[model samples]
Each structure stands twice: as C-alpha cells, then as structure tokens.
Target: MPYLFTCPHCQTRTEVEDEFSGQSGECVVCGRGITLPDFAPGASRPRNQAPGGSAGRRKRPAAWIAAAVVLLLIVGAGLIAIARVGGSAAQRVRQGRERMASIRNLEKIAAALNAYAADHGAYPAPAITDRRGKPLLSWRVLILPYLGEDELYDQFNLSAAWDSDKNQMQMYQTPAVFRHPNSQGWGSETAYHLVIGTGTLFPSTGPLGPKQVADGATKTLLVVEGRGASAWTEPIDIDAGATGGLINAASGVGLGGITDGGVCVVTVDGRGHFLSEATPSMTVNALITPRGGEPLPDDVLD
Candidate 1:
C-alpha cells in the first residue's frame, strides 16, 4: 500500500510504499532524514495526533512529523562498508573504520551491562543514590568493574554525588569504552546515551531485569549512539517521552544519532544494529517499550 508522507522540515509531501515503513530516507526537497509511515487500515494514523503537539502526545511523535526520515542503512551487524565523506578517500576510510569501532564500543557496553545484570540480577538503575535517595553516581560508574575499570570503580565515593569534588577529579579518567572513535573532539565525554522514560528498558526509577523486558531482549534497544557528547559521569540520557524524533539529521537536543544516515544501537541481546533515521517513529517507539508487546512487521527489524 502506498501513502503520502510529509516532510516537517521542508513541508513537502510525497507518496511512498508501506515496505519502507519505520525505515529512514531523505526528503527530495530539503534532503533531511524522514521515517516512513504505516499506512495499514485501522492503524493509528498521524491525523489522530494532537495538533502542534508532538510533546503533548509523546506516543505519536511520528504523527506530528509524518514522513520525515530518509533511506535505510546497513540493517544488522554488517553495515554498508562505504559512505561518502567530503574529505579525501583516507578520511572516508577512516570514518568507516571509526563507525565500526564505535559499534564495538557499544558492544563492550552491552557486555558490561550483561555482566552487571548477572551479578545483581538486574541492570543498574540510571543512577546510584544515597540512603536518602539522592543520586550519587551514574550507571556508568556502577558498571566500571564490569568494563574492567575495577580500580576506577574502587576510587569512587558511592555515597557522594557524581559532581562531588572527589568524583569531579576522576571524570577525566573515563574508560575509552565509554567514548566513540568519531567523538574525538568531546574529550573524555561520551556519545552513547541510554533511552529513558516510561516503558523503556531504563525507566526513570527502575532496575529492570532481562525477564522484565516483554518485548524480548533482541528487539529492545539498550543504548543509542548519540552525536552530541556529554560528561561520562553525568546521569543524563535520552528522554524518549520528550524527544520527538530518532536517528536523523534534524533531531533536536538529546534526540540526534550518529552521523551519515544510520544510528548505531545496541540491543539487550548484545548485538549491534544500525537504525536508519528514516525508521517509522511508531516502530522505534515499539522497540523502546520493554513489555508493550507491539506487533512489529517482518521488515521492521529485518
């Protein structure tokens, strides 16, 4: 079935097919990433969304900005080996290798997450808090030992806040695994962000175990490769409810993904995949929900 998709950036409309639903593609007019929409009958169409309310209707962000992503990328472990870069061929090759390395970084974090879950029976909450329930350190700090940074883990005063005098000094020593290769200019900061909010694997107040993810581990996104960098020790992450889009060039703060066309993501099963910025907002939402059990199309994750 084919339906019309409207680009929010350029306000241009085009007819597209359902096979591309939840995948990304570029707008012919302004050339921005656009996620395809599900034109199936009786499905929640974009019209039901709150007018000028992507924020008010978090669940239907795609509705507010219907048809705004671009083409799909390397789907699974194998990515499109080549991408065009403005610089010399060496730069392009270097970027390709760096993107691959960044995926490896995500895999390492996934391993650490598994190890932490294995030891504690659940993934660490977004942060570790004091007895009074005040946040003291981020999940990154809690997973230090799992990332083979045992010494760094031991030095932290778990009872103190992440920005405490003692902890602030140690922030510069963030493990290399926390940073992506292309995140060179960020300096000790990290680009990987965990998606947080209701229904997500990492809820605002939770320590969800593998058993809690009803969507199945392989279908759930564990970490998103963000384009912007933030302090590795800070507890900030993607707020799914607030961010309107995913894995695109026009994503606002906290919503942007890796450069080029694909957004690298790590699923709970410890596998890495490239999510196209054009992936339907609904499909992305379904994957973010831990136990929602939303039925996905065969091509959604394929």
Candidate 2:
C-alpha cells in the first residue's frame, strides 16, 4: 500500500509507501520535512474499490497534507535557535575588542603625560583655583592639548569649575583618557586618577630631601584608579583616613586590592606595570606619600 504526501514548507507533493507510514524522511521538492504513519500488514482495501483497485494510491493526497505541516514547524524552530546563538556570540566578541582598544589608548595617554612632566617640573596642577582656593577644574583639562586633544582643551573655560551648572561643557563629552576599558565601574562619570602628593618620592610641596632626590622621579607612582562615583581628581584612599596612599590588590590593603599600584602606575622611565598585591605593603604606602619609598624593580618600567 502506498500513500502520497505533500511538504508543508515547499508545498511539494510526495509519495511514500503506506507500510512506511509514521516513518520520517526529508521532502524532495522543499527538502523541508517528512513523516508518515505506518499501515498494518495485510490491510484490507476500501469497499468502493474501482476496477483498478487503487485505494492506497487515493489515500496519498491526504497523507501528504499532514506531513507538510510538521515539516514547517521543525524548520522554523531550528532557524530561530541559530539566530539567537549567533547574535549572542557576536556581542561578546565586540565587547572584548572594545575593551582592548580602550586599554591601548590609555597607554598612549600615559606616555604623553610623561613627556609633559619631563618638560615641566611637576605633574600639571589641578586647574587654576578660584580666589576661595577651591579647585576650579580638573588637571586633565590642562593636559588635553598635549594628549592630542588640543581642540577639546581649547574649548573649555579655564576659569570655570568643572562641575559648574552653567553652560554645558564640551570637555565632558570627550572621553577622558584615564578610564580603563575593562572598568565598568559604578557612577555615571569616571576618569583616570592622578596620585598627587601621594608619592613619597614626589614629596609634598616642600624643600627637596635626600629621599625625594633618590626616589621622587623614579620610584613614585603617577596614576592609579578610583570609582566613578568618587571625585576623579581626588587621590584615592586605602582606608577611611586616606593616610595610606598605595592600595594593593593582592593584600587587600586599602579598600581591598586597590593598592600595590593596583591603580595602574606609569613611572618616569615611561614603563607601565600592574603593581602586585604581593609587593610589600610598606613599599606601596611609601610610594604614595611624598618622599618615602625604596626603588621599584627595573622590570616595572614601561
């Protein structure tokens, strides 16, 4: 006994044996799907048989109609699953590449800062302050031109406070160089942190001491990281007192794993290194204060 079937996806008529009913196969025309119900062995033919007696052949049309429906369902489900998986994979790859690009740009910014320092005496001071001695702007605003952000820097009103509620500042729109790509840290606004007066070698504004002479230029850390919620220009603290400057990641020293140059440090030698928590806690602390550290390992250079 043979049956005829149609593919739902392609609307192609197909034929299958009645004995093979309930069996599954791909449709030839649409190549979509197929299955047929099995017939009992020695099944009797219909009573109103014609002279040629082709009951099995007559049943083929109905069988094909059912097969078509099942095929379409399976094909649709498969397509949906593939699309979903592909979309997720593509997103992950894109994020990874973006993070890497941010990191590279930061490296370049670090180099530019070093060059600025070599020409000038100290790290650029926070933007000039108001008569009340309040800092009017961030230090980054001053170094914009040197970092190839000349156009952005020139647009800012040097005399105004960075957080001024006055006219909207364009500098805010330009991405700051300090924020790391991987840092999806909290706060809507965050940027790189400069450790001013934290370096022991880079002593506070005071007469140069022997310690400052030895480590100030070479041993002090120039930059670290902080949360976006924090004032990006403010030095980060290890403890509530903020007396401890160096936060180590391994020792969980300040705010846990923020020391040990855990804030990325770029030395005068133009080398960049991730300070380890394993490094001496005292060494990390000494490095942050003005005029207090030992020489860092040579390898920690850029």
Candidate 3:
C-alpha cells in the first residue's frame, strides 16, 4: 500500500510506501525537503478533513508519473555512456591489431632478404641501375619472386624505369607485404625502405656481402620503415645523409608514421625489433652502420 503526500514548497505531489508515512525525504520533482503525511492509502478520512478526496487522488497519480520520467532519463544517460566507452575500447583493439600486422609484414620481408643473400652471397642492391648508373627499379621489385609474388614479378618491365608508362601500370597491383596495414589509401607506395649510405648494408655503389658487414649480422640494421610512402617499384630509399640518425617512425626522419611512437626495423640476421622514439640517435646511427664497429648499448633493445 502507498500513501499520497504533497510538497508544500512547490505543491509537487508524491506517492510513498506505507512504511515511509511520517518519514521525511527530498521531493523527486521539486527537490524540496518534504515530510510524508502520517496516513496509509485507502484509509478513512477524518471527519474534520475539509479537502475533496478526488483532488488528493489526482495528485498521487501525477507524482508517480514524474518519478517514472526521471528514472527513464537516468537510465537513458547511463546507456549512452556505456555505448561511448565500448566504441572507444573497440577502436583501440583495432589499432593494436594493425600494429602487429605491420610488424609481421616486416618480419616476412626480412626473411626474404636472408633467402636472397643465401643464394647470391650478398643482399640485393638497394636499386637496379641502367648503364648510365641511373636507378631503374627498387630492391623490393627484385625480391617479389621470393615473396611468392612470382606472377607480379613477371608482369613488371624490369628494363624500364619504375615510373615509366609500362611499369607504372603495375602500381595498382601493389603487394600486401609492401603496403602498410594502416595506410590511408590504395596505392603502390611502400612504407618499407632501405637506409642506404656508405656504411650501411646497402651502399650507394653496391650491396654488401655478409662477410663484408664487419658488425655482427644481428647488430646491423638492414631495412627500416620510412616516413613517406613510395612506389613499390621506385628505386628511392632513405639516404643516411638526408635523414641524420632518427629511427622512430613518423618523426620526419625517413620512417613511416605509426601511432605507437616506435619504428619497426629488420636486422641483417632477419630479426625484427621495434625501437622506441626515446632511443638515442647515436645508438640508432651505430646500428645502421654495417661496419662502423661502434659499441651498442646493452639496453639498445629495451
């Protein structure tokens, strides 16, 4: 059973359980402090009571209606909050998966490089050049067959420059291994690149054999993720002179942009590692050099 009550401050009506009769609580409608009437529902009115019974009944109905509206509002707001939080958590999970996929792509590329080295006694040159020494195709194109993309490799016109009309047509068929999982749009551009220079594995003049890498294979960086995307067949790559020593991706230092604030790198030994943005530039430079013989910090991999 419930008892009807009225908030004197705002004339707001409310219905309370019989147990709450004579107790005080704040009015749900007007937020005014109120004391419930000391009476139960359906009780006989006192002979001295002067109000119309119909008026009291109408007020009780109105109070219950207002409470229902407030409950709905609170429940709606709670549901919306849960939905927003769930959406954010799902987005984070997606980003994490993309990051791992990108890392796996680099690992596969590293394995291909090692396979190529085993057969040729040295890694592929950073780029293939014509008689005049102008670059024609990237090492990425050269390794297509090893990546199980033999059909794509056969479609390429290796004799022409990468941007040549015939070669350009193949851009639309970029391999999954060369494209970043989180790349903005579809294109033949690649996120992976070789850090070519005098002391690196891929020198300006030619590729270096494992024996030539005075630094241990595991200590030498063979390739890195670059900042800007390049055509998979393009001969361009990061020049150590132009990029300095920065290794973190998206730092505008020849590494691709990954939200994780780290860069994925493949060493000559076919191992992939993520280097933090906080890693010292000097330390990165030392790793890039195949034979600089610089001592690596014990925590370089940390």
Candidate 4:
C-alpha cells in the first residue's frame, strides 16, 4: 500500500509505500524534504493513533526494489555494449582508409611505368646491366628515379648481386611505392613484380608474330599486391607468361598462391578489377612450363 505525504518545507506532496514510512526523501516537484510514517493498509487503527485512524499498513514488498535494480543494470550493460560496437566500427573504417591510400600509391606507380614504357620501346627488361648485360637489379630498382626515390635508389650497390652474402637482397625493399600499407609484411627480391609475355595480343609463350595479343591486358592484372617475401625483387627465375596481365602469382605474393587466374589486377588504365579465377591446375602447370597452352575454355572467361 502507498501513502501520500506533504513536505512541510516546500509544501510539496509525494507518495511513498508503507514499508518505507521511516525513510526520508527529497520532494521531486519542490526540492523540499519529505518524511513518511509507517502505516498498514486496511488495518484497524489504534486508539492511540491520532486523526487518520489507519496508520499501520503492511510494508512495500521487497520484490519491487529488486526489479528496479535489475532494470538499472540492464540499461548500464546496453550502454557499454553500444560503446564497444561503435569503437570496432571506427577501427574498421580507419583500416579501410589506409588500404585505399595504398592502392592509390600503386596506381601512381603503374602510371609511371607506362610513361617509362612510352619513352622506351618495350617494358625495359627487368634491369640495367654492364658490358656482360646481366641484370644488375630488378626493373623495380630502375623505376626508383621515376617514382621520386632517387636518393634511396642510389643507396643500392647496383654492381652487387641479389641475395649475395654482401647485399642479402636489401634492394627488394627500395621502392616504398611497391608496398601497400595494408600489407602485413610481404615483399620480394624486387620491390615490384613483373609480368612477362611475348608482346602480342593474347600473348602465348611462342614467338610473337604480328598477330598475337596478350589476353586481357587491359582487363587482366599486372601487379596487384607486393608486401615483402623471399622472392628476389628482380625478374627472379619465373618464366614470362600471360597470367591475366598482372605478374602477381594468380593469387598474391606472401598471401599464398592465387589459383584463380585473376588476382585483383590494377591495370595501366589506373582502374582495378578482380580478374577471372584461373584454374589452379592450369596455373600450376603453367608455372613449371611457360610454353604449354591449354587455352582456358571460353567458359573460364565467362
């Protein structure tokens, strides 16, 4: 049972349960002090009790207080849950921004490569060399000047061989542009990977006649990702083959092998697209023998 009480200080009225009669509380409406007298509900009044006659009532049940406490705890828990979820969302967005920046850097590198190619006839063979004409370093090594890392590029001892005891393949990390910020530490003998094929339409390993084309050069990938890895940055012994444009293994470097012929390839066009998945069996066989032509079924393209 509940009883109404009037606050003498501010003349405010408040309702309190019978059990809380001895407790004092502040008036919500007038900021005045209020005190309750214990009273029982529907009980006979004692002769000693003054005017109201019914002062003794059963006290408020304890169950109501417990329910209130549970409600408060539930609300507090909900707030904490919301805060954690918001924090995670923010982290994901930040990572996404970093990834975008890395991709853009790759785009700029591709453009530079194109400009270099335009100046020269074909993609400059992997690297520049001396009278012996052996590759002194990877093409990625040569592109440093064009990518605005002239000082860093000069630091490399071009005369030294890759993975030799002296250099230990440090040249592979020269180009900052070669690595994506999102890459969790994967790279190569060279900062960049190279795509090789007879400069022809639908390129096949055999002689490039006037009529061959590197398949999907525009749609295929040239290089999508490079972080850091065991493969030397220079043309490292992989046979030049037509692999959906990008030289990145059909999968990705350091990420594990990409079997789907198409890794996410960033094209000379400065656009990025996922290339068709190359059949794993076909790609593996191609890696061993560059000349084998099990032309991917047209369906594979679809």
TM-score of each candidate structure, all chains considered together: 0.67, 0.53, 0.72, 0.52
Candidate 1's residue-wise lDDT over 75-135, tens digit each? 2113334433334687777867876787899899999998889888889888788788776
Q: What lDDT would candidate 1 get against the real structure?
A: 0.72
Q: Please give the ranking of all candidate structures by TM-score, highest first, separated by commas.
A: 3, 1, 2, 4
Top-scoring candidate (lDDT)? 3
- Please give, for residues 220-256, the per-residue lDDT of candidate 3 as tens digits: 8887788775788888888887666765544576654
Query: What does the lDDT come to for candidate 3?
Result: 0.75
The list of candidate 3 runs beyond 4 A from truth reads: 1-85, 248-251
Off-target runs (Cα >4 Å) in candidate 2 are 1-106, 183-188, 198-213, 216-218, 230-263, 293-302
- Residue 12 lDDT (model 1): 62
lDDT of 4 by residue, 1-302 (tens): 44555557665444444455565555444545555555655433333333344346454543433332344456768988999999999987875665556556657766766666666644445555657866555666666677887776667677766555545546545455665554456554323354444542113322221112234334333444433453544544223343343333435432113222233335545554443434453442332222344355443322
Please list the C-alpha lDDT of all candidates, in the order they appear. 0.72, 0.51, 0.75, 0.48
Please give the distance, in angstroms, between residue 157's alpha carbon in candidate 4 and its true position after superposition. Answer: 3.1
Roughly what TM-score does model 1 have, to 2 decimal places? 0.67
| Residue 174 miss distance in model 4 (angstroms) | 3.9
Worst 10 residues of 4 by lDDT: 204-213
Local distance difference test, candidate 4: 0.48
